[model samples]
Target: MTRLVSYDEAPPEVRRVFDDIKRTRGVPDVNNFWKALAIHPPTLERVWQNLKQVMAPGALDPLTKEMIYIAVSAAQGCEYCIASHTAAARAKGMTDAMYGELLAVIGMAAETNRLAQALRVPVDAAFRAAPPPPIPKA
Candidate 1:
């Protein structure tokens, strides 16, 4: 059981946040994570706004962003975040094949990262920003 405020019993400020959450997510239920954060309304609002900005469409599509969130959550061993982001990714049209591929890539990247860290490999100059492409002859 959470020590934080419950959505139904939350104060006006918290309820306003909850209402915004419902409207934005189009879901009537508030997740326990949000309810737990309600203990500090300011933090709750700040996090919600930040999430909105970060998750909104931009260079990357929402599905890709959710997949990245899932990857990071898995790497950090945050089961709650992994579960939530996996569901979000699936809702955004991720398939079993894509999930399998994503996990494979994540595993490979993790292994390579660990190896590089253990060996203290220096990043190659070639990997740095390509020397400004030779200026085209006017």
Candidate 2:
């Protein structure tokens, strides 16, 4: 909250990233998160690039990615991220019922995760294995 660089106040490099964000998202302005990051232009550019790439559709659909982001944000108790991604998910056609179910799942996971840690549960042999192989190329 200390430093917020608006588009008018941003350096050319920061403005470039802001432009991309607006253009890619089809919006008139970049959000406050980007404005905050614009204080550090290099990091702003890097994070923007990474976000664009990661949020692009590949294996997971865009809506699913947004929902995943919302879940992680909720787990981390980040109000900004939760609100932002929840808006995105709603824009992508998430129903009210889906939002309710997602919250329920998050609560259940938190309960189970804490219980497991408290009980010091050991990993089952059947569940221990090498990471699954990468998806085959088309």
Candidate 3:
């Protein structure tokens, strides 16, 4: 059985935000992460607000944003973040093919990034000064 903790044990402000979070986010109960973070309700609220604001629908569609999130989480090796964002990506309309390509690109980029770091590759002056290549006429 899960250990039950009384909200009275939590800080008064934490309890207020926890109640608000449950109501606003429509979760029947507080998630483990939030329960732990309830130790710092103000910080939790700030982080949640910032995340929600940035992730809301905008110039980038939700699925595309989710894909970006997944790629970053994968690069950082945050398994929890990867799982959450991948599920969000799928919910926002990612397909198997798209997910495959996304993973491939992320993997390739990660490999190249590691190689560059390992080799201590410096940006060449020639490449930095190079003009844009001419576009082929379609």
Candidate 4:
């Protein structure tokens, strides 16, 4: 792994994003993920900005969003994200019971997803949605 950037050694661009992250999350320092991304300041800033917007409370409550993030992270097998989002969820008032239930749901979903894939299950008409918009050319 690349060296994690320290705040004292960071350049202006990294420092700006780091400062924002620290302020927004009310943390003494940004986590190792941000530290790693610090090597690429543009990506660090972009991800930080996007995370702030997406994780902010809106239609769904903060705890709900955090749990959803945890579920997706678990499914992707991203250990770091799962751990990080779990902590965030706890802070957002996720009790032990909620965590247990979330884990059960994640496990069941994973099992069913794999089984469906292996069986080549067709999508039910009622469960199908309209196609998404075309991706924009980069």
Alpha-carbon TM-score of each model against the true structure: 0.89, 0.95, 0.71, 0.90
lDDT of 2 by residue, 1-138 (tens): 558899998889999999999999999999899999888888999999999999998889999999999999999999999999999999999999999999999999999999999999999876787678798889
lDDT of 4 by residue, 6-123 (tens): 9999999999999999999899999999999999998998999899899887879999999999999998999999999999999989999999999999999999999999999999
Clashing pairs in 3: none
Which sequence of candidate numbers ranks them by lDDT, best first? 2, 4, 1, 3
RMSD to the hidden true structure, all candidates: 4.8, 1.4, 6.9, 4.1
- Model 3 spans with C-alpha error above 4 angstroms: 1-31, 126-138
lDDT of each: 0.91, 0.94, 0.80, 0.93
- Measured by TM-score, how close is model 3 to the native structure? 0.71
Give the backbone clash total of model 1. 0
Best by TM-score: 2
Candidate 1 lDDT score relative to the true structure: 0.91
Tens-digit per-residue lDDT, 26-131, candidate 1: 9987787898899889999999999989999987999999999999998999999989999999999999999999999889999999999999999888877567
Q: List the residue pairs that clash in candidate 2.
A: none
Candidate 3's error at 30, in angstroms? 5.2
* lDDT by residue (tens digit), candidate 3, 27-129: 6776665666665668767776777788878878889999999999998898878997898689878999999999999999999999999999998999999
